[model samples]
Target chain A: MNEIKIFSPATVANVACGFDVLGFCLDSVGDDMVIRKTDKKGIHITKINNFDLPYEAELNVAGVSALAMYDAIDVNFGFEIEIYKNIKPGSGIGSSAASAVGSVFGMNELLGKPFNKIQLTEFAIKGEALASKCEHADNLAPALFGGFTLVKSISPLQILEIPSPDDLYATIIHPQIEIKTSESRAILPKEVPLSDAIAQSANLGSLVHALHTSDYKLISNSLHDVIVEPYRSQLIPHFNEVKLAVLKAGALGTGISGSGPSIFSLSKGEETANKVKDAIEKVYSKTGIDFDIHVSKINVKGVKIIE
Target chain B: MNEIKIFSPATVANVACGFDVLGFCLDSVGDDMVIRKTDKKGIHITKINNFDLPYEAELNVAGVSALAMYDAIDVNFGFEIEIYKNIKPGSGIGSSAASAVGSVFGMNELLGKPFNKIQLTEFAIKGEALASKCEHADNLAPALFGGFTLVKSISPLQILEIPSPDDLYATIIHPQIEIKTSESRAILPKEVPLSDAIAQSANLGSLVHALHTSDYKLISNSLHDVIVEPYRSQLIPHFNEVKLAVLKAGALGTGISGSGPSIFSLSKGEETANKVKDAIEKVYSKTGIDFDIHVSKINVKGVKIIE
Candidate 1:
């Protein structure tokens, strides 16, 4: 009980029409972490492998998130952490979220799960803010609670765990490019046409309904982003071509994953997901951009113990 | 059967955060009509009662909708409709929708329902346009399919019938003032803050989830209209006072129903609905505006046959 090894999965936020509120977990892509109890009185990051991230407790997302949880509890001992990073920073697939959720999840497990999911999400958001420069739970909620999550409200931090369809799979392609969350957010207009807002709400509402009923066709029709995608897609090279190719390959829908550099397509089955992956790969390979593609089922369980 | 008599229920469109896309049917307020087969070649409005509406087929909402449906069919016989209107025009409670739905629903029944709900909605929208100057299926979908409905899209006409909780009830207060839908719509800003749009979408997404799970608290939390209400509420007299009184009376949520003047509050059960009605009535009594209030359960069977 004093030590734990866990795998924290990556997540896709915004989710087309569900901008700033919805996200889902990925199964095949994640980061592994090891946490052990130490008599030292606070959170300490002893090692970080494969990624050159800050080792300072205040600067590292994992360390900062673990510290948030640690400061709230009356534990006599501290925790030591070692992260084996797999999700690259600024890949637009919740890279910081994986690390933030991992540390808090591991710390809670070591402490016999004192805080609930919402509290854990709060702690994670503190660390997530260091990356995005704003507090958002879209990525953190899905990573901590698994499957699909909706940040219904931020002031109260209400997160609704939407049920992912049994056959749902995600195809994600990261082009090894960085789109800083702050810069991506800056490009959006301060105001949007009211007509577009209504359309976006309709799509998001239908998407929620589609998920509840497991209607793939409705999901396909509803995965439209009339509000954010039009502007943000400009930042990602060949975004339109890749989306068109994936849709033609039978993806239910495609959009920029989170902010950019990574694009995601949702398909009904694993086979179709792989087809979508191949389609996107073909499109991206021609662009001569270094890319990583993953086809994974919707991870129903968020962060989990590896050993 | 050559003849059919029906009751087409009134519906509350907008429903707070669901402006332009969501609505629910009401049990008590509606219009009654009798549609019969005729040997003649076209639709005829035989008699009008209680309300002074256009007798000419083309000018009437019921006739316009029925003609739309009749024209699409290859039937030899025409039809005659007798209207017994109870729902007042410009009530903002889908008064036109009730009449429009009644004719098509009765005709569909007479013709053995050759057209499905979507086709019926298509016909209904043609009629609704006469009243609102735009085609929207929010009210018509609920009035046709019963319970709650979301008009996911307009061009392809996607209607999703959301399930209503067994105990859900509605309290409506009509303040006998005219606010034309077109004019009410004109008062809204052409552009809205992007932040408000995101908040509106989040509320709508949560509302859909609340409907699926029968979570009353979530429904209460999600029934906020951030985009439309601020402007539209100004048109209704004593809106703020009535809303405060109803919420204090334990109503789940309250907002301008459809376009204005008439306000709607949703409650978990019939008892609370009646209490909400009483609360609104108390507030409106002092405002010197004549009003009518009705409390009813969610009409799950939208337009129904009485004989």
Candidate 2:
């Protein structure tokens, strides 16, 4: 195809105790993008709607990722990308990742799938680094591969796609506040107690098992974040109240989505997810913050063709 | 049902990056005990062989565990235990755990299996604390629940039984040197770098997934211990050389078994496991230190009745 229209899904990274290593894709929240081959032999960002994103190929996340993939291939043609941004930037639900994955995903499709998911994730990481100031595949991997993903290692770029339970749903509330990925990262301590580290690993390991077995109670018990959440949650207002409310409202677990400002909860079914959304809305609405709430089934497929 | 003879299998705890949380039961290395019910009141250690252990009900690991179970139950009779010690204490291979687990398991069987594995594990932990000076279930959970286990939480005593790959085998070598668990624990830093902790959790999460999916290569990649091994391996003689030798011999991974002196390697099959055993033997033979090696399949049954 000369041109492609794709729906790039948002993602939740740092998934409670799985900080920096695990993430999952979202179904209902994302960005729509159209990529077209051009006679001009270079990447270009032609238009971006609903957001004032940089049009320069070098400055844009989508462009940077597209260029990363483009430079590595022997393609004779260039591509122009138009982004219809729906997920807001700096909301911690992987807005940049959606754009970053969309560009390379569309380009790879237009180029007859020259690379695997790992390679596509590598390109996405370059673009992600521009936003987070560090390379992490947690968000990028899930966005590209779909479902839940564990980034086993970054140096070798190993990503394992974990099975997402069929009944799993995610409820997210972004409080319309900005929490820069870099600043959110900076607030974390350089060192953590060894006991806390062990506990975090135990929880993450248990969560992986729970996902495989589809045991919701184990998933609920394993969602604690003893390492990063305590520090980053301070950046978000009503974090404690929202968490307690959601848990009480039947969420299997709740935590900061990626960096902060966006809080996400996992539930066994879409009904519980919407109930969790209502709980979160109840708590955040009182603060008079212009927040956005989404109830989504765990997206099993990552980026998909819009047509 | 009034009397019971049991074989309590040994376990390897702190399996690489799963420090303080994970373990697996062994098929061949274990201890045997005969527990008999009597009309006379209170737990008793009637006879001991091959080892000098305290006979007092409260002082012995087995007796302490049996008493812990007995004190909580409204029993009309007491039990007598005869020890047939096989696994040497302080070999870093769950000798105390075998004894502790044997008592509770036998008692539970004789009492019509009233206690669940978690309750039995709790009783075993009380006895284990007598040897290690801290409560941990990494070893006891596997010994009670069988196969691979993750002790997700200690306070609430949560245990998760992980599936063992059918082809998995373990090769353990004990160098006959004493390194107390408390000493090994004391040598570790109270805090670790945030980056290392993240890497550790990633490896552990990957390991759990590997076990579920039966991906041997992923298990090999994820067996790295970035937190505790560096400090504890220093206590073991030629730790680095033995690790290299086993990895080169086609072992999936190798690490200090429980604490030090004894090292364990996991292989995909018994053939590779035997090869790993030869590699360990070759390395330890040059040091002129007396050592013992055992090759065992991953025991799906934790403790069994010796008919």
Candidate 3:
């Protein structure tokens, strides 16, 4: 196959109790990249559609990630890339990660799948670093492996694909606003209090257990953030109101998705997930911010070849 | 049946990265207590067995715990308690939790199971408070529930029974030397660095996921404790040496059991567990501390009636 098309799912990082380690994929929103073999000697971006991301190989998330992968391979390869972006940029839902993962995933497909998912994650994270300023994989790993993923340790690049419950659904409300990734990261506390850190640790442990056990109530109770959210929530308009509305509407948990401008809620069934989406949209609608809502089962297939 | 006997299994709290939230039961070592009905109206300790625990109903872990449960019930009841302690005191394994849990467990059985496991955990924690000066239930919950347990939050007393793989085994080595619980806790820093705290949160999240998914390698990597173990290891002689020996023998993970004095390692299957136990014992035996070693499957039954 000289040409291949792959779709990378959007992901929510931080994931309430998990500050930097937990993330899951969203099925509805993602970015698509189509790679075509080129007679030229190097990777290049031919076009980017419906997104303002740079098309230059060094400047684009997908192009940059593919460049990293291209350099790692012993044989030289050339490709012309076209990106059809759907996951909104700065939505806190891993838009850049989708692009980064898509590039490597699409490149791997074209190269006859030489690298495994983990190695692809490494190349994708390097691509994300070019865009997000940090070589983190919380978002990229989930987008690559599907389901719930944990970047257990970044130094050794340990990415764990956690088993998730069958009935889980993700409801996300993406407000039409932009928050720079660097600015959102700047709002987090550099030093967390000992008490809060311990509480966060316990909560993160419980949240993972809830995901494993499929206990919605435990997930609800564990979906608390006293460290980054309290301060970061100030950046999102109507954050608490939307959270309360979603909880009252029966979401198992709700939190800021990735970095902000988008809020997410988790529920057991699609019907409840739709209700959660409506509730969140209702609150955001009152603020007069144009928002798009997506309710989907957790994207269990992170980045995959599109047939 | 006016008399009843039950044995409460030993527990290992902290579980490396989970500090005050996670624990699991050990199969072999525990405390046994017998409760007999008396024609009186107050709980009393009639026989104090091989251990030096206080016999007064209000002063001892068993007696104090039994007193709390006896006060909660509306019916008039009296009991004579006999303690046959096999788990050593100050072993850093859940010796005190066994007594506290055994007391309430024995009393609850005699009372025809008035309180459920959750309530028993509360009463057992009250009993632990008589000994540990705090009401934390990390060890007590697992001892009551019979598997890996997580105390997600203490505010509303949320305790979750986490699933563990059937093949998990525990290897423990208790040096005859004793370290007071207060002394071990005293050495920990009041505040952890921000970087370490975040790393610990990720480790704990991964650890819980590993337990649920039965990923042994993730369990091994996540067993690192950046907060308490570093501080408390100073109180344990040859701590690093013992850890290296066990890891080299293929133990999945190792850490201070509850506080100090006793160290525990988790491995898959009995053969690996025995090897880890031997590896640990060989290192500690050279110190001439007269250590006791145990290898057993995870006690899936927390406390059970012996008669």
For each candidate in the order shown, give its overall lDDT on alpha carbons: 0.92, 0.93, 0.86
Residue range A1-307, candidate 2, lDDT tens digits? 8999999999999889899999999999999999999999999899899778899998999999999998898767899999999989998999899999999999989889989989999999999988777888888999999999999989999999999999999999999988766788789999999999999999999999999999999999999999999999999999999999999999999999998789999999989998999998899889988999999999999999986
lDDT: worst 10-residue window of model 1 chain A: A176-185
Residue B168, candidate 2: alpha-carbon lDDT: 100
Candidate 2 segments whose C-alpha is farther than 4 A from its true place:
none
Q: Which stretches of candidate 1 lie over 4 Å from their true place?
A: none
lDDT of 3 by residue, A1-307 (tens): 8898878889999888888888999888888788888878677998888867787899888888888998888665588888899987888899889988988888788888899998998899888998788889989989999999889888889987777788899898887887877788887767777778889999988888887777787888888888888988888888999999999999998888888878889998999998988888778878998888989898887788885
Candidate 3, residues B56-85, lDDT tens digits: the string is 788888888888888888766588888899
Interface RMSD of each: 0.4, 0.4, 1.3
- CA shift of B56, model 1, Å: 0.5
Model 1 lDDT tens row, B1-307: 9898899999999999998999999999898899999999799999989778998888999999999998898978999999999889999899899988999999999999788888998998888888777888888988999999999888999899888889899999999888877778789999999999999999999999999999999999999999999999999989999999999999999998888778999999889998899898889999888999999899998999997
lDDT of 2 by residue, B8-115 (tens): 998999999999999999998999999999999899899889779899989999999998999899978899999999999998889999999999999999999999
Sorted by TM-score, highest first, which candidate order results? 1, 2, 3
Ignoring the other chain, what TM-score does chain B have in each prediction?
A: 0.98, 0.99, 0.97
